[model samples]
Target: MSGPGSAVLAQLLAQSAGQGADLLALRAIAEEAGDLAAGRALARLGLEDAQAAKDMAELRELLAAWRAAKKSLWKAVLGWIVKMALVLMLAGLAVKLRLWELLE
Candidate 1:
């Protein structure tokens, strides 16, 4: 006989057809399947919910870290490019005035 969790999963899957299920919902269903296969129930469902929450929290933290790193990298690259351009411009002016030959 199917359990309450199976009923819930079936309903969620039906409702989510074509649009794709939410990550949390899919996690819950996967946990439910494991528990059902193992002949267990509520405990596994609760554990699955906790796991899903933890996963979401971790994902958010990672995304924030990535964004911060990307911003920092872009800033550093832009600063380096600006500095290099200025150095090249100065070098060009020095060469035009024969300053480079004097140093040689």
Candidate 2:
């Protein structure tokens, strides 16, 4: 059955059923023959590859979200520092002007 056509392979596959056939070997042969079984196997492989790619994409998205959150946290902390500095400056100005003496 060297270089058998797809139709012949299909016929053989149909005939081989329940005859204790080695389906793995037949699948390999079908791959060489470019038969329907090979097409099915390749479709399964394609689905697996697509799933892997989707997982990678999700991981990348998670990483991007983490980076954005880190950047936002730094910005909030920096803003807090500026606000604290401004408050301290205002208090120092009041003390310099002797405004505290009026509180007595």
Best by lDDT: 2
lDDT for each of the candidates?
0.78, 0.80
lDDT tens digits by residue: candidate 1, 1-104: 18997698667666776477576777677788776866445456554455766877898999999999999999999999999999999999998898978877
**Residue 61 CA error for candidate 2 (Å)?**
0.9
Q: lDDT per residue, candidate 2, 2-104, as tens digits?
A: 5567568767776775587887787687677666656678678664454766877898999999999999999999999999999999999999999999999
Give every collision pair in model 2: none
Q: What would the C-alpha RMSD of candidate 1 be, to one decimal place?
A: 11.3
